[model samples]
Target: MKDRAVLYTFESVHQAIKGEDVLRAAGIACEMIPVPREISLSCGQGLRLAAADAEKSEAAWRQAAVSWQKKVHACRVDGRYRYGVEN
Candidate 1:
């Protein structure tokens, strides 16, 4: 499979920060980033992590009661990013 990354968009800044905390607490590496233009226009905050960590990140957030508004798949090519499927 192609190397993939995950993008998580939040409904608010608080949720984004909470999500990052949850992931980090669970030992999953993630970073806060700008929500992609294709995702939404409202919240500008999101989280980025390797696709390998997606499942663990999801579990961490749910277990910690951290809510995210959307999850998107990102394709990384030649160190550049292109939008992928949104869930």
Candidate 2:
């Protein structure tokens, strides 16, 4: 719970919107953000959630069948974000 962020990039805007609603209904806090530059060049939406809630969010997504393309874990370092890995 170190303020780390978990980013979930979806294949489509509909999926991203659906994902946000699903997570919210599951009691997982999440935000919809522009897909990160490194993740995709095309304009797209992503769901950002607390890293501490990653597991819960993942389960919720799976149960809801909310499709997503990627899940990346990022940490704040020196006031900048550093994406460490993907899953």
- Residue by residue across 1-87, what tens digits does model 1's lDDT show? 455788888878998888888887788898798887777877579998988899988888888888887778887777876667442
Q: lDDT for every model?
A: 0.82, 0.83
lDDT of 2: 0.83
lDDT (10s digit) by residue, model 2, range 1-87 = 245888889999999999999988888888898977887887999888878898888888889998888888877667766665532
TM-score of each: 0.88, 0.84
Query: Candidate 1: lDDT of 55?
Result: 90
